[model samples]
Target: MPATDPILPATNGVIRRSGCAADTVAEAGAVSLDVLAARRARSLPPGVRYELKGVAFTLPPVRALPVDLPESAGGDTAELLRLVLGEEMIGRMAAAGFTLGDFELVCEDWRRRNGLADGTAPLLPAAVRPGGSR
Candidate 1:
């Protein structure tokens, strides 16, 4: 938790949120890979497909920690993701250019492949997939 991060600012050695920082942190904390993927997929064309490659995403000081995170989490981001995204979400992943079908496909494929239907993610309800769920 560096003092430089915008979401969790350091003032006198204490961490606190300012302005929309709370909302941003809350949103980031509540985010799930499935829902994020679905939203991204919904915006793409049916025939659209991307390639797979490595990506880099930097988390801010309070990215994985919510302003109202339950105390039981013990300040661990992995635990928070598990609580919101499920145990299958052992960590975080990100992508930019070159992928596959949109992110939704990867999440689905992972689910079906791993049989990780713990029901903690895929926040967006199932809809008529653009490309038949790839």
Candidate 2:
């Protein structure tokens, strides 16, 4: 049957689980609490401690209207993380701290939630299935 049938409700009756609980996944990427305390001590200038307060990010956000991810980022999520941190958000792990692994984990989750990749999480057991339960 055509999906756009006028008689059918726009919804599937059951709200299956997707990548995110929110309606739209933030393009900046998902935040991880584990990275809240993300810090790496630096001695470049000698005893310059690094401390990130209130920001625990991984994927970083687009500067423009869900528009661009910065030209420097390319198609590489790791590069994106590296470049984005240096963009007026040193406290966001762009500084001399945080690792590629940290950023990648969050990006993976973001991808799934945004439907950019496979794995949308299984549909939760609903009270009723679509078109009504048996």
Candidate 3:
């Protein structure tokens, strides 16, 4: 299956078992939370210390903003946003000024409108199925 394919409801069970959905999403453009946190730390002002078990750690003095990850970190910015914020949460974020769009939903809607089966590739002229021509 293509990485961009929408995870259909019927396949949810298999996905839950295999745990490959997360991997697929990551491959599509999800960034590790660790990497994001580190990037945020670097943007903070110097000399900022956070108390943890009475140990002072000098780091950036600024609070991390809920900004979208950079494109370089994730090949597809929208996919990264979806992965990080999740579908529903992302809608709330979008209302708050984030420019990210729900690309997957859009694709799904398009597929349905075109009468294509969920997760099925679009028909191509001269294309043949594994067993025979369609």
Q: Which candidate gets the maximum TM-score versus the true structure?
A: 2
Query: Which pairs clash in the backbone of model 3?
Result: none
Instruction: List candidate 1 stretches off by more than 4 Å.
Output: 1-51, 54-95, 98-101, 117-134
Encode model 2's per-residue lDDT on 25-121: one tens digit a residue. 2334544332222221221122112233345544422221122443334455545545655556544454546566655665565444434444332
lDDT of 1 at 51: 37
Model 1: ten consecutive residues of lowest lDDT: 56-65
TM-score of 3: 0.21
- Candidate 3: C-alpha lDDT: 0.41
TM-score of each: 0.19, 0.31, 0.21
Alpha carbon lDDT at 31, candidate 2: 41
Write down the lDDT of every candidate, Cα atoms only: 0.38, 0.41, 0.41
lDDT of 3 by residue, 64-101 (tens): 32332322223343354245445575455455554323
Q: What is the lDDT of residue 41 in candidate 2?
A: 20
Query: Model 1 residue 5 lDDT?
Result: 73
Better of 2 and 3 by TM-score: 2
lDDT of 1 by residue, 42-110 (tens): 654333132345532222222223334423344343444345444332233332342334445544543
Q: Rank the candidates by lDDT, best first.
A: 2, 3, 1
